[model samples]
Target chain A: MISSFQKLTIAFTVLAVFTGANSLHAQQFRPAPNAHYPNHALMPPGHVGSQMLLRGGPIPGYFQPTQVRCPQGGKIAVANEGKFVAGQPSTLNVGLLIGSPYRFKITEIPGLPGTELFPTVELLDRLHPPAGLETRFPIPIHLTAQELRMAAEGMFITRVIYLEDPTNPVVVQDDANRQRFFDVRFNEDPLRVADQLGRPMAILRMGSKQPRMDRQTGRFMFSSPPVRTIMPVKQSNVPEDQLQRAIISTPSIGRLR
Target chain B: MSKTMKTSSRSYLVLSVFLASMMGCITPGTTSSGPLEKQSFENIPRPNQPASLTVSDANSKPIHRASPAAHQQRLPAGVATQQGPATLPPQAYTGPNAGIPYPAPWTPPGILGPFPEDEYVYQGGDAYQLTNVAQDFSIDNLDEEDTIAHYHTLDGKIEIERTNRIPIYAPRFASIRRIDGLNQYRHQDHVYAVDSPLALDGTAQNIGQEQVKQHVSTQRNIGTRASSLYRENQKLRDMAHQVASTEDSQMLKPQVGDLLNTKVNIKNSQEAQLSIQQQTALAQSDEETVKEYAYDLLPYKILANNRIQTNYHYEIADGNSRLDIKKVASKQDALPGELLEFTITFKNTGDKAIGNVTIVDHLSRRLAYVEDSQNCTVESEFFVNPTGKDSAILRWEIIEPMNVGQSAQVTFKCRVR
Candidate 1:
């Protein structure tokens, strides 16, 4: 006669064998991390994928000089430090560097008073102009009163400035003094659209976040970042080509003073 | 008397059954065939053609054999024969059985025959068009043990017999007694029982009982073993003595011939040191006085001269222990740490001489100039200046002015950091 202990031992052995057999068929089929999505851009910035596209030297006239044109009766200040007077009808032209972002203060809107908007400019590319003529072809950043009002009213606005494609130019009779721009829906990416149309030059973002600068308060504020200023060329009756030749023949030509 | 009669009857029955089984084993009769054997014979397929028979008397005349023409026809068409076709007789002949060819065609047996080739021919359909595909079978419903179908039931259940029983005659004894081996010992008494046969004590429980005895024979070569051990010890002592004596001799008088002569001669050592010091001082002074300049980008000067067209391009240098140059356009991508070869070509298309031609390049901070990599077709003076870390300024001044229709090129190498 088989005792209870012997019967239990046999039962346990049989159970273990069955368990092992079941385990063989119970494998979890986990796919590889990048097997399905090989080109996934999940990695953060500065990764190898992003750095590979950052080869070659900086574009010509990088950080040389850029002129910022404001609305009429409006004034502009660099980094909200009030560089330009409140009532001055002048445009702020600072030599913004690529690979860095700069913030600016917009004040004295024609219709809206005490409405100051801080906008950030991120330069993605630069123009290749002749030496000492960097200011002549500065990146024109047009801040409309509508965008300023929206930003002042706590609405976010994003504008992408792109260099028009010479091969495929936009056929529009736009004002020579003002840049040609368009609007996109909220769900659309302005930068991507700008790249599709032409070469994306810069990205501008404006919102209603006030500065947090306070003494001994571990606070942050939009302090004016030092920039090289380029003097505008004097108005003359000289031909463009002759003027370029004159500049090239000078002894200190092409050298940034 | 009744029991004996019953026993005899049972024996008779058993003997008859055994004889019957033995007869079946000895004879190959129809009754002895198993189910499998019968089934195999019953499954044999009928032949396609009926067999034919031939009858002849023992004293019949010799039969006419087939002519040589028949034999030649059986041979391959290309094969050469000793006799020509014209000399051969007519090949018509009669088979042993009526109405049959001399060389009958062959066919495989029915059991070994395979399905016709047309049955396995692929039908036209696109296997890659997987849209609206239907799954008709499940893995769970598959019969994994179908290959061994005979061993299982219709439901695929394998029944196992775990218990086995056999008939045996009953014993007369009512109880079973355990038999203790010779290793039995009483722990409480701490002594062997007096009546035990293997007891060492000289006391016997019975007066005339015999005690178990054992006899053993052994042969040990003590003298040979001792002599061998002594010889090994003496050999070890000799080795130890030799090592000790050698060590003592070396300690008392070291061998000079085994040592290497390592004395090196000194010639103008102080002069060499002074020259090295002077070179270091000059390098230090140069480093202290070197001028730094901001980088500026400018197009090739020849772009302004319609008479001379300047072409500037760069190529990636890659190979296995050698340079394999491949041109890369400005829009193409390049990897870091790759070697780049830059070339500037200048051609004179005018009818006059171009003099004092100088070319300068401001290398980007990302590129490091390779040492001694500058090359030029014309005699020129090359100058280099470090603008910043991993950056440099290169300038070349052509010593001889280029004449009409003259072309010159300058090439250099740099590694992207």
Candidate 2:
């Protein structure tokens, strides 16, 4: 009886080990960070990259007006040469140049009351919207509650904003309230992956780091680039959830506004 | 060994094999192992040549529109597909031959007659005669009209009008100089070939010697005339130089009539005549005090007081693709003291080789070229002309010819004013 039990145990252990190996092999390959990856940390805060891009003079569709949406509702203010302004409540519609980095503050969180978070948004590229309707197809930046909470806990989070490729889209049954986003492993670069999937519009970095007291330090932290204030998008009569879905899905169709 | 020990040993062996297999899956290919900036070519089209011209920054993000209509739906937002404002359309190239076919089928062996291989033969006589031969003295080919018609101008003054005529009347002595030398030679050759004896007599040989002497004498006269013309031109050039180099105080002042009496447009069209007259009148009035000053100014301007350096880059197309180039700035706008980098991408997108590829960029007045900032994919010779106060010309010469489908990149930095 003892011998038979031992044989049974060995067979079960072998099968389990073989299954685990196969599962590991089936996993997708993730690229390792290159030597230049360290420079990402060396970059100073604010839109220094964007400010430099201005040197070549104005290019068409460069300072594309993008909308920053705090889905949970908060005071959105932008920094002017490191001075945070008295922000508008909930959403801020501002014109940001492509290849520019922008920093803005989010305060008076709806659920996390009295809480403020400073996030840097880098517009690595731009979109070609319809002629007169540039503001209509603004790049929607959704700052979710979960992301904010994690960031508040002193965790660094990076979200790559990308225009979903119509040809090959991630099929998810997401409504207006919930935008579908997936998390990659800590080692994998979300920016590279987003670029492979579609055109990466902006790179958003959210962290608990606050501005320093020194003037020069503050300048690097919160750069004041030229900003064109655009009118807020009109609130639609349709339900919030349905409206969000339509806006996101409409751009992926034949005629992109 | 005990049963439990044996089972544990078997499990360990299976686990080791599994671990080795799993290790292979975790580590990916080299493609993914790099920084985002190096590989971030969001604006550059795959395989290149999506548009003839594409301007992208150091990070490879395109800043200009390429082709609006065709690339509207295809390209990313700010980086439209089309030529940038700085890019001009390629100039039209119609070659010297134009509509005429190269090496026309009827082109004979270049005037070099039969038995060309026999170098010892006196071939210079015929060949030299072909070049030096006096053009046919015909009335039809005269540059000036033969008949001078006297007509009354609107002012009632008698005006001379040179008009073309049928030349039925006696020709001008100057117009009827000599017979066409080439025709005379051809006629003589035809007679000699048909009438020459198998062996020449002494009389015949003597006649040939006399003919040779006459030919030599004619050549000497032509050389003397050419020498005289050269000396006259030299004297004129020396006088012009002296006039130009003379001090303002030493220059002679001209009377008002000397300025007004200058005649222009002695040849060519009426429009040309009118333009030249206007220019001459303006110059004469501007420098009424000095005739030589006005005379030297036009040629001095034509010669260009400013130095102009010319360099060439040869390119050949295989009847398919062409050499395309683009310039992109790292930053469209920059602060006065900030450094900006520009990238120039050149590619030979053809089946044939392109020789001595060169790219020339003119930097704005506000930009100052940074020293030792240039980087190129292939070995190249770089030159910069700093004489321009408004702008600087940057030139990159690729020494080695680019083969089919070959591409190269050149980058340099500049500081904004």
RMSD of 1: 57.2
- lDDT, candidate 1, equals 0.42
Error of 1 at A44 (Å): 13
Candidate 2 recovers a fraction of native contacts equal to 0.00
In model 2 chain A, where is the ten-residue run with the lowest total lDDT?
Answer: A248-257
**Candidate 1 lDDT by residue in tens digits, B1-417:** 999999999999888666655553343210233454343333322232111101121012111112334334444455554463211211111111111111221223463212111111111111222112112211121110000000111222221111111111100000001111223213313332323533322232222122212111123444456888899999999999997666434222212312111112324654465345434544554333121100000122334467544554545333211111122112111223346666655555444455545544545443456889989899998988664233466767677766767767777876543
lDDT of 2 at B228: 82
TM-score of chain A of each: 0.63, 0.68
Give candidate 1 regions above 4 Å deviation. Answer: A1-53, A59-61, A80-90, A214-224, A232-257, B1-417
DockQ per model, Cα: 0.00, 0.01
All predictions: root-mean-square deviation over Cα? 57.2, 42.3
Q: Score candidate 2 by lDDT.
A: 0.49
Expressed as tens digits, the lDDT of each residue in A173-241 for candidate 2 is 222223345455443456555545555566677777676646755554444665666788764332434
